[model samples]
Target: MANYFVGDIQGCYDELMQLLSKVDFNPSRDQLWAVGDLVARGPGSLPTLKYFQQLDGAANVSLGNHDLHLMAVHAKVKRANPKDKLEALLDSSEINSLIGWLRHQPLHQELPEHKIIMSHAGVPPQWDLNTLRAESLRVTQALQSADYVENLLTKMYTSGSNQWHLEMGELEKRIYCINALTRMRFLHSDGRLDFECKVSPAECKDPDLTPWFALEGKVNQSHTLVFGHWAAVMGEVSSTRIKALDTGCCWGEYLTLWHLEKDEKITQNKLKKS
Candidate 1:
């Protein structure tokens, strides 16, 4: 009856297995929460996808940036760049079904009892649980629809404010995707989205652009935010209630798992890919 949340897997299937073995994870009784990026830049994307596909009922996964990139490529919304070595999955016969399943996953989830909130990338400082879930539902619904979601991904980057507006177009959607997945690291001095910096120490071109969790007057301080995406930050949430999970397992680092109820952590070292 314990729920464990894992950081970005990033296709490190072997290490994932080892971590699961260490925890003695029981699919029937215990549940697993994955913060997303189940594939990409690692050695075992195919197996990882297959294994998790089978664990459909036992686990909950939020889509990560890399996961969306895989989906975009699958849908022909985008091309596979040389850095993306996802050919195995793209060539698989079950590619459509697999991508469909991944796309259907929610962008955010809330566990009221534990006061736990989960998303691949951290939520904006302005959004509370209800606002986050509603906006996320809009994006998820659009992506799942047969409409040209390629347009959505195209506009998912964030060069302006972090706040969502009803007037935003496809470009904003793409910016939202980027902010939610890849381009998030620091907040601008004026509390806008900064798409450039990745290094920590929290200092940047403008020091006032604190990280999202550090923004002043955030409304959703009531719950604990558990997220991944920022490997450089390791597991820093900046704010007291927020927690990061991505330990950079795909980059020769450790895979991290945190127990929701006990606040215990388990780290598994990984073998680097050649």
Candidate 2:
């Protein structure tokens, strides 16, 4: 069976279907793995969630920052941003099941046989593969727990706490791990995750900031890192080991699909909102 890695769909269900059609994707045979942000900021959030929700064995995804925020909104921890066009999704009868399925998705997906790793954001330079698996699981288990909103997600909203400290309590620790997996973009010279800088490296004037993939002495080098997020990067990075999949479809650009076995990329431009 052929495996395809799609970029952040972000509720662009029409483009997703078109991309799948382009590949002649057979749900019974081929598999689609999304980098996440399966909902939000596009015209088709409800149907997009429903499509994957029912696609079952043919589809899988990692959880993105937006996806987590959706859960937070459902749990009354955060208000939904109207700009994201999630009204239909939030109002839908199936939102509970949809969010439940989304919460269960992992933050990172490992393709050990291919020596590749996929996450909403790339793996941190300081974390080895084993650490990625372990830390991600901790958050995953918390999300799956019944008390997640009250016990875990509510306390995770503190900002600017990117540095991982040995003395950190659960709140700080979970925030750090979540940021590394979801919001990370650049890093300070000291290798701390930088959540504020959203510009591409060329536009970034800060000399102290380095793209995470450009950092030296990173521990997880064995596996190629595939990630979506940091739409500003627009599928460009310093090395072959790093693949930036988000093509800014939500911002009037294109949706990208990475054909895994062939190492080929296919793209479909975002259609105008009806």
Report residue 66 deviation for candidate 2 (angstroms): 0.4
Candidate 1 runs further than 4 Å off: 148-151, 157-178, 181-183, 202-205, 217-219, 272-274
lDDT of 1 by residue, 134-251 (tens): 6777767877777635456554533563546667765565466446544466766655666567766454556556777666535456778888888888786656687889889888
Scanning candidate 1 in windows of ten residues, the lowest lDDT window is 154-163
| lDDT by residue (tens digit), candidate 2, 1-274 | 8989999999899999999999999989988888989888998989998998788988878889999898888888999899899999999999899988988898988777888788998887878766778789989999999999987779777786688666877667778888988888899988788877899989999999998878753544677888999888999987887888999998899999998899999999998665
> What is the alpha-carbon lDDT of model 2 when measured against the actual structure?
0.87
Question: What do the candidate models score in CA lDDT, each in turn?
Answer: 0.76, 0.87
Evaluate model 2: give its TM-score.
Answer: 0.96
**How far in Å is the alpha carbon of 120 misplaced in model 2?**
0.5
Model 2 CA deviation exceeding 4 Å by range: 217-220
Best by TM-score: 2
lDDT accuracy of residue 228 in candidate 1: 89
